[model samples]
Target: MATRVNVTVDAHLAIEVMLLTGTRNPQDAVELIVRDYLERAQRTEARTGDADDGRRSSDLQPYQPPQG
Candidate 1:
């Protein structure tokens, strides 16, 4: 299930995102942002407490999103 949400961003910021991600679709931009954020969140959560997860600091290394 997905819920509709509204967000406002400056025109320049949007253009920068499109150029950076190379995705013109607004939905794609939002999806990438959400996915990246969630991955970082998961890494942080694992570091906070979860021995068997094996998600150490190195596992959370930065990701350079490929240009499309």
Candidate 2:
């Protein structure tokens, strides 16, 4: 069983989340918002991939002018 947590947030913020999620229950709205945020983050990470994938400035070559 998952543990239940109690949180206190500003009423206006909660209302906004409720409206966005189209839920009447504050708990459901908050849960949906958190879940959506995590999913988006994961999707972004998958699309962009790891920052350390390893191309560096030292790997670049200086540009040369063409001979006429």
lDDT of 2 by residue, 1-68 (tens): 99999999899999999999999999999999999999999999789776676554556789989989
Estimate the TM-score of every prediction.
0.57, 0.72
| lDDT string, candidate 1, 15-47, tens digits | 777777789976678678788999999999766
Query: What's model 1's overall lDDT?
Result: 0.79
Query: Which prediction has the highest lDDT against the true structure?
Result: 2
Off by over 4 Å in 2: 55-68
Judged by whole-model lDDT over C-alpha atoms, candidate 2 comes out at 0.90
RMSD per prediction, one decimal? 13.4, 4.9
| Candidate 2 similarity to native, TM-score | 0.72
Model 1: weakest 10-residue lDDT segment is 49-58
What is the Cα-based lDDT of residue 60 in candidate 2? 75
